[model samples]
Target: MTFKEAAYFILKREKRPMTAREIVEIALKEKLIKTSSKSPDRDLAIQIYDDIRLNGENSPFVKVGRGLFGLREFYEQKREETVGEVQHLIRRLEETQYRSNSPSEFEEVLKEAFSFLGFETELKGEPGNTDVVLKAKIGRDESYTVNVDGKTSRSGKISDVQIDWLSLEDHREKTKANFIVVVGPDFSKGNVEKRAQKSGVVLLKVKDLIELLKEHARYPFNLLELKRLFETPGNADYVVEEIIRSHRDRTNFLENLKLIVEEMENLQSLLGYFSVDSLVARTELGPQMIKSVIDLLNSPLIKAVEEVSEGKYVLVIPKRELSKLFGRLASACEQEKEQKEQDDVKNKLVKNELTKDELIKYLSRTERVPTVLREILLPLCLKHGVVSREMIKEELVVRKMAQNLGQAGLVLSTVSKAIGENELLESIISYDKLKPWKKDNFRLKEEYKEMVHAVIEELKGKEQPKTDLKNRLVEYLSRTERVPTVLREILFPLCLKYDVVSREMVKKELVLRKMAKDLGQAGLVLSTVSAVIGRDELLGAIIMYDKPKPWKKDNFRLKEEYKGLVQEVIEELKEIKGNLQHGT
Candidate 1:
C-alpha cells in the first residue's frame, strides 16, 4: 500500500488524534509497512502532511494540532463544539453591558483581551489621549505596533461626538503606528459609520471585541493574520468577497466565451441572428448561465456580439466596424490624456522660444497652433511673406468676416507672396469666415457682379460646340475657384434631360441614377447644387437674374444666353452615344 493509504489506515484504527511519530512507530511495531529511510518517522509525517494539504477538507487525515493528525470526521466534531462554546461566551458577554464600568477598568479589560490574542500592551497614552499602544511579533524579525483609543459611555449607545475623540489621523501621526482601532460601546448614527470607513479607523464595539477575544480562545490566530483585520478597518470582509467574485466572473464567463468561439468554424457564422432560447439550445448551456455569458461577451474588450433586437443578438465581428467605434473612443481618451502633456510643451516653448528650423519641425509634427504668441511670432520668422505681425493682428481682431475686403485682400496677398518665395503657409482660407459664406448661399459684394456678367457674355459669344464649350467652361472655373464637384456631375445631367430642373426632377433623377441612397444623401446633393450655383460667377449670373417662384415646378433655368449652348452640348453627347452603340 502507498504511504498515504497506510497513514489513513493507522489514523482510522487509532480512533483518536496522534502525532506523526506515534503513528509511524505503531505501524512499524505492528509490521504494517516497511521503509529503508534513516528517518522513517519524518518521511511518514511529510507524506501525511502532503496528502492533507493537497486534498484540504476532503483529505482522510485531518490536522488536529501542530504535527498531530486524526480522522477527518472526528476533528470536525471537536472544532464545532469549540466554536459553539465560543459563541455562547460571546452572547453572555453581550448581555452584560460593560458601558457603566470605569474608564480605567475598561482599559484593563481591553489590555487583557489583546494579551489573550498574543499581543504585548502598554499604557503609553496620556489620561486624555489614546488608551493603549500594542506591540506584536508578526515574524521572527518583524514587528507591528497599533494604537487603540477607548471611548466609554454610561448609555449603551455612543454618539458621533464621542466617537470623534478617537482622532485617528492625530494618533497615527504622533505614534507612527501601523494601525489604529477605536473601541466604543456602540456607534450612535449611520454617518458615524461612514466617517469610520473614510478615516480607515477600525470601530469595534465593546461586545464585538469580546466576541473576537472569545473566538481567539477557541481558534487562536497568528499575529500576521490579526494584523490584516486592523490594517483594512471597515468592510474588509465585503471587499474580500467582491475581489473573489470578480475573479470568478472573469474565469467562468469570459474564458468560457473564448473557448466557445474558438470551437466554431468562424466568428462570422455566429453573426446570424439568435434569440436567447436559440442560443441556449445551440451552446448547450443552462439558460441562466448563457445569459450571464452574453452580458460579459457584449463588453467593448470582447465586442464579439451585440443585441440587435428585443431578445435577439448577432455577432459584430467585422474589424472595420469595430475599429471605427474603437477609434473614436481611443481618440477622445488620448486627447484627455495628452492635454497635460501639451500644456507642458507649451510652457517650455514660451520659456525657451525655439529656433526657426526647430519650430518648423515642431509645427510639422503638431496639429494646432500651440498659442497666440506662437502665431504672432510665426510671421516675423518667415523670410518672405506680406503677412506681417500687424496683418496677423488685424486678422485676429475681425473674428467673423462674411465679406470683409481687408481680410480677403490680406489673405490673397500673403498667399501670392508666399508662393513666389516657395514658402509654406499653414492655411490661406479662414474656415470660420468661409462657413458663413457657404451658409448664406455665397452672397458676394457688388464688385463681383460685373465680373459675373462678363463671364456670361463671353459664354454667349463662344463659337465652339455647346458640349465642348460647357466642358471648357467647367474646367476653367474649377481651376480658378473652389467649385463643388457634385453640381457638375449630377446637376449638368438633369439640365440636359429637362431644359429647366425642379426639386422633384432632381430627386427623381437621383433615385433613378442610384446617385443617392436615401433622403439624407438626396438633401446633401441639393445643398451642394445650391452652394455651387450661388458661388460660381457664371452660374450666379444665370440663376440669380432668372429667379423662379418658390412653388414653381421648374425652379431652376439657364438664362436665355446660355440655353442654346446647353442644348447644343446635349445634342453632341447624344450623337456620341449613338456612334458608340453602333460601333462606328
Candidate 2:
C-alpha cells in the first residue's frame, strides 16, 4: 500500500489519535512495507504527507497532525465568522451567478449531496457571506431548517466570538435538530465530547462521519444517544456497555441466551401471546429490574426479535418459536430464585451465567433494529389471520389484565370475575399468557355472526386470481377472509361500492373461493387492496361503510383519517410529473 493508504488503514482500525513515530513503529513491526530510516522512500512518505494536507477535498487521507492520518473530511465553518462581510460576499457571488445564470460546480455538488439525504436545499445570495438553507421533511406537520455556516480551516487559531454567543440552553434550542459536526481530521474526541456535553449537541468527528457515510447512511445517528454519550462525564460507559461490550462478550452471552431458548421450548406449547410479558411481570419486577436482568435489551437482542418477525428467528425444536426464548429466560430467573433456597451450586451457576459483560458482548455483535416488539406482533396476524390492528390493540388490554392477574398469582374471586368479564384494552398484553375470549367464538356477538359471515364470504370471493385488474381487485376486496369486524366494515363497503357492482357477484365469488379452498391444494388469487388504499383510509372508509361506533376504537382514528386522505396525494404527484414532463 502507498504510505497514505497504509496510514488510513492503521488510523481507522486503531480509532484513536496516534503519533507518527508510534504508527511507523507498528507498521515496521508488522512488516507492512519495505521501509528504512536511511531509505529514500522516507522522502516519498514526506511527499505523501504533503498531498494529504493539501487538496483535502480529493484526498482520502486526513492529517490530524503529529503524523496522524484519518479517512474523513475534517472542516466546517464557524457561525459568527461572517454576518456582514460574508453576507456581502454571498450577495456578490449570487449576482455573479445570476449574470452567468448558472450554478457553479461547487454549488451543484453541494446541492446533490443534500438532495441525496432528502433535503430541499438552495444556495442563495453570495460567496463568502452566502447562506445555505436546507428544508427537511420530518413528519406530517414538522419540517426542519438547517443553516450551513461558511468558513475555512486555520492551523492553530479557533474562530472568534461574534455579535452574540449562544447560551448553553439557547444553543441547545437552536440546534436541537441540526448538528455541529466537526468535519475535519484535526478534531479531538475530547473536544467533541466537551462541546456536545455543554450544549446537549451531537458532535460527529471527521472519522465517525466518514464511517457513517460508508456504513449507516440510512440509519439516523441517534442525536439523543450521542448527546447522552458525550454529555455525561461517564456516560461513555453506556456506549461501551450497550454497544462495545455487547459485541466483545458475545460468546458468553449467547450461552445464557440459550437459557432463554430452553424457556421458550417449555412455554410455547402452553402459551400464546401472553407468555413473554407475563413471565417478565411475574417476577414482581419493575422496568428497571427487567432492564437490569436483560442487560437493558441490547441492540443485538432487539434485532433478534426482528428476525423472529422475518421468519429467520432461530427455530427451536417443533412448535417452539423464538418468543419462547424470553419465556425460557424468565423461567431460568424463576428457577434460579427457587434453587437459591435449596441448591447453592445452582444459584452460583445462575449468577455466573448472564453477567453484564457477557450480555453486552452478545448484544453488540448482533444486528441492530427498532420496534422489535411491534415486528413480533406482525407474525401473529398470519397465525390468527383476522386480527386487525384494532383487534390487536384490544387484545393487548386483555393481555395486560391477564399479566396483572398472573403476577398476583392468587385468583381473588372479584378480580377473577373481572378478568372473566373480558373488558380491557388490546394493548395490555403478554402474548404468551393471552387467554382466548371464552364467552363466544371469535369475540363476535351472536347477532353479528351472520353479518360477520357475509363479510368473510365477501372477502373469500375476492380471492380469485383473475387478470382483469378490476375483477382481481373486486376479488381481493371480497376475498379477504378472517377479517376482523373493524376491518370488515371498512373493506366490505369499499368492495361493494367500488368493485362488486352487484351483490350476486360477491356471493358467487365468495362461495366459489371457499369451495375451492375446501378442495385439497387450492389457492385463491388475492392481492392486498389496502396496499393501494392504506390502513388509515381503509379504517376511515369502514366508518362510512357501516354506522356503529367501533367495538374498540381509538382517537388516533383522526391520524388514520388524515393518512387515508391519500386520494388527495394524486394531485401532488400529478403536479410534479407534469412539471417534469414540460421541462419546468
Q: Assess candidate 2 and give its TM-score to the true structure.
A: 0.21
CA shift of 329, model 1, Å? 63
lDDT of candidate 1 over 1-584, digit per residue (tens): 66567778888877887766677778788888888853455566666655655565577776564346788866783364345445544553354335343344455456656765679898643444567889987675668888887766777776667665356677777777888887767777687677777887777776667645664654465676566667677534443344334445544664465544442224336655765576565677667776776675588676767887887777666545644666566656755534553344334323322232333333322111322212332332232211243444454455332136565445434433432343222221111111212210111122222222222233335424544656855454344232333444456556645667777667666666677787667766666667667666656654532335542223566665565454544455656558889999
lDDT of 2 by residue, 373-484 (tens): 1222333433452233334434444544223533322222232233344332121211111233221111222122222233233333542321133233333343435443
Global Cα lDDT for candidate 2: 0.36
The TM-scores, one per candidate, come to 0.26, 0.21
TM-score of the candidate numbered 1? 0.26
Q: Quantify all predictions' global Cα lDDT against the true fold.
A: 0.54, 0.36
